[model samples]
Target: MIGVIGIIISLFLLMYLAYRGWSVILIAPVLACLAASFAIFDGGSFHMLATYTEKFMPALAGYIKAYFPMFLLGAVFGKVMDVSGSANAIAEFITTKIGKGKEIWAVVLSCAVITYGGVSLFVAAFAIYPIGAALFREADIPKRILPPAIALGAFTFTMTAIPGTPQIQNAIPMTFFGTDAFAAPILGIVAALIMLFGGMFWLTHVEKKAKAAGEGYGDHKNENLQIMDPQYLPSFVTSITPIIVVIVANFAFSKWILPSFDSSYLETDYDTSFKAVSGTWSLILALILGVALVILFNYKRFDKGVVECLKDGVQGSFLAVMNTASEVGYGNVIKTLAGFSLVAAGMLSISDNPLIGEAISSSVLAGITGSASGGLSIALATFSEQFIARASELGISPEVLHRVASVACGGLDTLPHNGAVITLLNVTGMTHKECYGNIGMCTVVIPAISCVAIIILGSMGIV
Candidate 1:
């Protein structure tokens, strides 16, 4: 009983502190230890610190082993896009074609295109902000809306929506659910539409309201980062081809190429089956293709040095992967506690529908961990077996499970505590007080609503 109380305390603390901008690396273990103390004592085990090394480290190690390559490749690919001016060229082309009157939409779509193309969320914001800000200022929209506008594109549906995206949030579920990034293609598209149009409608409505009230981009010129001059940028066609390559190569490989191989070697364990690793292999290869093509296409533009970009990307990937791994460790510790059983059982009982249960579980953990990938790693690590069993019994497709979990992570994971949200606010020079509301609505509420809609449609066999 006391263990359960401790678990609740830990859950609330994790969410509140994470929202308060605590580092997940530090806060996660502390909270995990706090929760584990009650359970350890109740279970007549006094291995306080040992619980961390034994339970926590193993989980972290497992995730790192499975995902570090993808993180490294993804970071490098995004950085290459940033440094090569590919992402900017694409954004500029779209914004230029759309002209100036609809600057807000242009900014949103520009970020969306870059992000959906597999640029890191941070890189997308950093690269897009100058363009977005210039457009927003010219169109005289509120600067406060910039965060949400960028977020709506980069953080909301695209992170989880489009099939074959390289976002780690999308990739995390593939290992657990035995499905690929293109899981439940029709349902993913439907959810994508709901989030995309829903967020745009709200942003557009707010833009009109704020404009009528004379809300403007304000005088924040001092915060603007000096960016690349457009003259050196690659042509829009050359710039966008890498993104196209990734999407096409991923689809071709996953649909036709990989199955041609003798994948029977993957059947060593239920967890490492073909379904579980196919998504990982597909995305990894696709990202590698993205990196190769971007570098090859823009080989001359990299006079500043490709090696430097690789170093930066490698360092960034380590940080990104380690942070998520630490949170996974924290979650593993919590799961071993007696209190976690109650929480898990309650969440499991929320719905007989595995899709619904998986969504709720993934969303809650994401909210707690303040990271979409981190929370997702924890949820799947802890409850994937149960979910798979339930899914099998219910005759649900693993593809549905993959899509649902991915989308659900995009929900409450964008709460203010989220690292991506904080980084974006800093990058865009927006404050949480002034801009977080809009960011929350677009990235959190809209995605969540869309997630529920997908579940309903799936339940009715519509998707």
Candidate 2:
């Protein structure tokens, strides 16, 4: 249909322009209007301005209302960790424990530890890059490998496949599936292992090939960001405690504490059920506790002043959340179109197995949007009801569905235009041409393989 062509054309333009580095916040609304413009020819009452105001704006506002707390708290938590030196200390300790002559492994593990501990992916990269670059340079490894090494740790398994991870990508699924963060624990572990080891093996092989050809760390100037001052940083114990606090607090709250709260009056008092909000509540409280502990442990070490640190984080949170919300708004507009019905029907028909269709739909949308959280949010918003119904009819657990959908979005979402990928490249001062191949192997190809493996395992009732 002409409308489907228009939608596809709009999507192509979105990706193309985004790949050229235009801001999605600037383009998403414009593209939403473009996609909706075709509806006028379909013999329907479609007002472009009305759709933007009524449908798109409401969807955007709703996402902000529901998720702004997590985004704000997460950015603040990551910021405090950075300013107080906790993130640097943790990365240093990890790299030190991994020892000398294995710089790539050290960088990967250092990044993995901090990001899995709930540090934002961007913060993890900024915190670990100086250390990783130093290690790679000392070990005579190619500097270009550093970004991919960091990407392997920060962007793949820890962000998606790991159980109990507090990343927003993982948290987004909880509300949709009415499942907690630790969904499909056994299957999550399997996928995590596949991405971690599989990625490491590829990196190791790349290292060996480069060494055989005598490729050494090339000369490159350090980025202008503030370098970590070891003298003022807290000890490893003080630095790591906050991360542990977040992990333990998240687990206890999600598993025990929040559930014990009396919400029986919700039918009369609040419109929502307890299960609908418990997962988000757990992460929010855990992040708050983590931020409080980070300050408590390093109260005097905030070189930028606590107010300034908080301001920077608050600013960052607004930008990050707005970008994703705009994409969600674009999706909301797309869903209202006549063409989207065809796309949804095709997605649902991908497999008799709901898991396969779920995986493919989430991954493709994520790839199209070039954002994991945005695409995952949109997919769940659009197809969650169908997935839930199909899954229930087929005897599939919602927990498995949660795990699959979470991991599925992560793979294609890291394509070159991804915000995180661009930030990683900028942090390391590396070009996509110089290192994106490695990044693709680690974050994209490997994660996809892991996702496929988990899909098979889920289909086999292994979850």
Winning candidate number (TM-score): 2
**All predictions: root-mean-square deviation over Cα?**
1.9, 1.4
Query: Per-residue lDDT of 1-463 in model 2, one digit per residue for the tens?
Result: 7889879999999998988889999999899899888877786666778988998899999899888998899899999999898989987887788898778888888888788778899999989998888778789999889999999999989899888888889999988998888889999999999998998899999999999998998877655646577777789999888888888998899899888888788667888888888889998998999999998888898877889999999999999999999999999999889999999889889788889888988898899899999999999999999889988997889999999999999999999988899888987899999999999999999999999999898888877
lDDT of each: 0.85, 0.89
Rate residue 179 of model 1 by lDDT: 76
Clashing pairs in 1: none
User: What TM-score does candidate 2 reach?
Assistant: 0.97
Score candidate 1 by TM-score against the native. 0.95
Worst 10 residues of 2 by lDDT: 221-230
Candidate number achieving the greatest lDDT relative to the actual structure: 2
Q: Candidate 1 residues 324-424, lDDT tens each?
A: 99889988888777777888889989889988888999999988888888888888888888888987887777788888889998899888878889898
